[model samples]
Target: MPGCCLWGSAPPAPSGERKGAGWLELLLLLLLILSGWVLTQQPVGCPRVCECFVEEKTVKCANQNLTEVPPDLPRDVQNLFLTGNRLRDLSSGAFPSEPLLELRNLSLRGNQLEQVGAEAFARLPNLKQLDLSQSALLWVSPMAFGNASSPLEELRLSNSLYNYSVVAAIAELLQRGIFQNLKHLDLSSNGLVSLPPGIFSRLPSLQHLDLHNNSLVSLRDVSFGALHQLQRFDLGDNALKRLRNDTLAQLRGLPWLTRLDLGRNAWVCDCGIEDLARWLKESDQVEAKEALKCSEPEEKQNSSLVSLPISGLECLEPDDDQTQLQTSYVFLGIVLALIGAIFLLVLYLNRKGIKKWMYNIRDACRDHMEGYHYRYEINADPRLTHLSSNSDV
Candidate 1:
């Protein structure tokens, strides 16, 4: 039993720890567990002025009041949360190391961030979701998201943007080949009156666009020219008094546009409203407002849409400019048609005169036909006929 305790029988399996051997084995098991846990909890050295901590495999830091940018975090953390922080400045090399950073989701929402550097976000190679909503971002670097290799799928900047310069900056970046992989973007509750032409010209992958609760007055034609992949567009809560026919018509060409929001607007439901209603009817999805309210007739504004387009009110033409342009197009078309008709008539008359001249020639030939035939007959007789016809002479 001493040397052969192989069963129950194994002497109860050495009831207590076997000193050195048992202690070493237990220590190795504990080390293995700790190692497994370490793979989840990455290194977070800074415990001052920031609440950066490792939660499972994520690095969550938020509600901090740091003035400047934070340091480079653990290279392995995929989800980094710095929401509700007071991060104001964003300089280059302020973000953590990337590719190795492996950041997929980054949340900087509810922060006092005002300026983000140009190359601040370009360093993240694996980033997919970025949340900068509810911040005081006065300006976003036009080239911030440009040439980004990361597959950033969603970007939130609504209710945080404070300036229209952001549009120009974004427009500049788009022109300069920025925002390549961006799919979703939000800029609602901002201050914007109008957008530049060809501003959103290259965002082919952008699907959802939020411009709700903004100060947009009019949506110029071709404003959304490049958003062929757009599925949802939020234009709710704006100061648009009317909708241009050309703008709505061009926007209706978006192949994937499924949802269009026009609520909470000062929509007069006038002729401009008619254009939008027409767009809604032609579009796949839309919702009309409850009713129309008149803007008073013969007002100071020299527009055709003085009275709003109530259900009883007729959908007359809104502004004179749009109608003038339409009239100009029509007049030009009519002029071209008349010119084409004149050309065709002139060609027909020339052909008729030529035919008459040919008729006179035919008459003249008839009169000389008998004399010519007699001369040819005598010349072609006898020896000529025999030589020419049979070579029998």
Candidate 2:
């Protein structure tokens, strides 16, 4: 009787309430299981060898000893770094069949890539920057970027082209107008002796050009004529002897140029180098002006180009004149020799005619001599003349 009053006791929970609580508990357990599974699993669509940052949309497969590109790259990965791998060649099918529509940066540095196929990067439509540094790139197809207009802006090929042929290949590739929008080009440490004329003519938008640590001996005035928008240029650590006045003038005319590097070169401080020395002393654009010392002429050796007086950078005018005169004499001698050779060749070609002419002259001379002898005899001996007249009668 003491516990019999159901109204006094708390009312029992409704079946609907119990059912709802059970359902909530079940949902929470399912959520917990899913979260655990997700925590244990790799990122969705990420390759096993690569680390993918989903939030940033970057995938790093560097130093993985990958023989080929990871096939399972995230569809939305914007920056893909495949550096320090063993990828020897980038064939047409190196990337996945599905194009990475958002990929912006690609790095293949430190690979053993010897060749780049024509369609190697055809799928990366929106790619902006490419770094192929430290690769043993021996050959690159002229159409390596495919037929579509490239949106590439920065191209880093430093220390990649091992030989002149490879450099020439890249030069040919550049002449094809594939990377017209390129803004920054790094060709440093490539041992380039000389660049093909008009190689950078198509890259009108080029701003930064790095040609340091090369074997370039000279540069043409048109070497950078197309780089009107160029801001920074590096020509350090080369075998350059002098920059002519016209070349210096062209460099001075760059409207946007802010930095110029001519240090560590084999600068010959002669009258020929006076223009460069004067420019270095006057302009604030040259970097490491102190390091641009005269590497030739024992007296001027190690002298800083900027500090050297323009008068000090002089050549013996008399000696130059004598040298020019000697050179002119040698040139004249060569021309005379060539003319003599040509005349001899012509005579040899008409030898038969010449011989006939000589024979005809000898015959005419002999005939004239005989007639003269006969006339003299007739004039000297009247008896001989009378005998000749009797024979005619």
Candidate 3:
């Protein structure tokens, strides 16, 4: 229709017709309608000073440079990550009357909190993990952990608190068996001494314990006496002077001991460390069989306490007591062997005595036969005659 100017072409239908575009348009329009309905359904006003933004059911306004506690959260937020915030000093009643916090999987890590209020986390019955690490905490209130005996599976307090009070708090937890189901605990890089008594002992189900870079001097007896199911133990970079035999004696017997890292403790080279060295000799894991010598003070550092490998680390001479111990063991083995040899000698002597008796009986029988039937009764060959016998005629 070159000259007829046909008005029927419909401008080529505006090209780029999307497949199923009508259904997609309908779905988007329906979603918009639903969103409008939801907005209208909200009964109350929006919270002030809290950037309230919701997505389906979650409302997150974390990292708002909050000074006190982050309060007035949504009522149904199941997962809340309050990281990279300025919240400090979570006092009591910080999260009061907040319904969503009760069911939230909260993380308050990397905050500026100096002290955690007592019974702060007493609520939140459904909380699974509470991360308080990297908060630069100076103190921890008693009962700061979960209540009702159902603590979070992973409680991270690394770089959160330290010193005597932290130890005291952990000890208190141990005494009461508060962390019965705690799977992992991170107390690394803290100023801790030996494991506070009753703390590690109470955590029966603990699988991992991170206590690296602590100021642990010695693991005395009863230090790690309880961790029955511990798979990983990190005690690196600590100022450890000794790894006592009794302290780790129970751990050595654990059947599930797979990884033991005692790399940087600088266990002073001495007879005190011999027990571990000897155990490593018969071990299939852990490479501590060599003398664990001191690695500082270049002059006297290379020396070891004694030779556990029978030819290394001969710094200390075998003392009197050591010699006595060796002597006792050697004497015992030698005595047993000597007793066995003596018993065999006695048996041989008994057999020889029986043989001589039979020979004497046979000779007597022959002498009787000769005397009765043949010639002289007691006659004997010249070679067999005794000098003391009467001269034969």
Best by lDDT: 2
TM-score of every model versus the real structure:
0.61, 0.70, 0.60
Candidate 3: where are CA atoms >4 Å away? Answer: 1-63, 98-104, 145-147, 284-393
lDDT, model 3, position 348: 88
Q: How does model 1 fare in lDDT?
A: 0.69
Model 2 alpha-carbon drift over 4 Å, by segment:
1-41, 312-393
Minimal lDDT window, size 10, model 2: 316-325
lDDT (Cα, tens digit) per residue for candidate 2, span 29-85: 999999998866567889998888878888999999999999988889999999999
Cα lDDT for residue 207, candidate 1: 93
**Residue 125 error for model 2, in Å?**
0.5
Error (Å) of candidate 3 at residue 359 is 99
lDDT of 1 by residue, 1-393 (tens): 555755445444454656767889999999999999975654556435544455544666666665544565666667778887778877666675444357798888888678877777877877889888888877777657536554778888777766667667766766664566788988777677777677778777899988898888677644777888998888887877667777776667788877777766665544446565555544555544332233433341232322333345444554653455578899999999999999999978799788899999999888679667755775678655534332221
Clashing residue pairs found in predicted model 1 = 7-10, 146-178, 269-309
For candidate 2, the C-alpha RMSD (Å) to the true structure equals 21.1
Candidate 1 RMSD computed on C-alpha atoms after optimal superposition onto the true structure: 22.9
lDDT of each: 0.69, 0.86, 0.64
Candidate closer to the true structure by lDDT (higher is better), 1 or 2: 2
Q: Give the TM-score of candidate 2.
A: 0.70
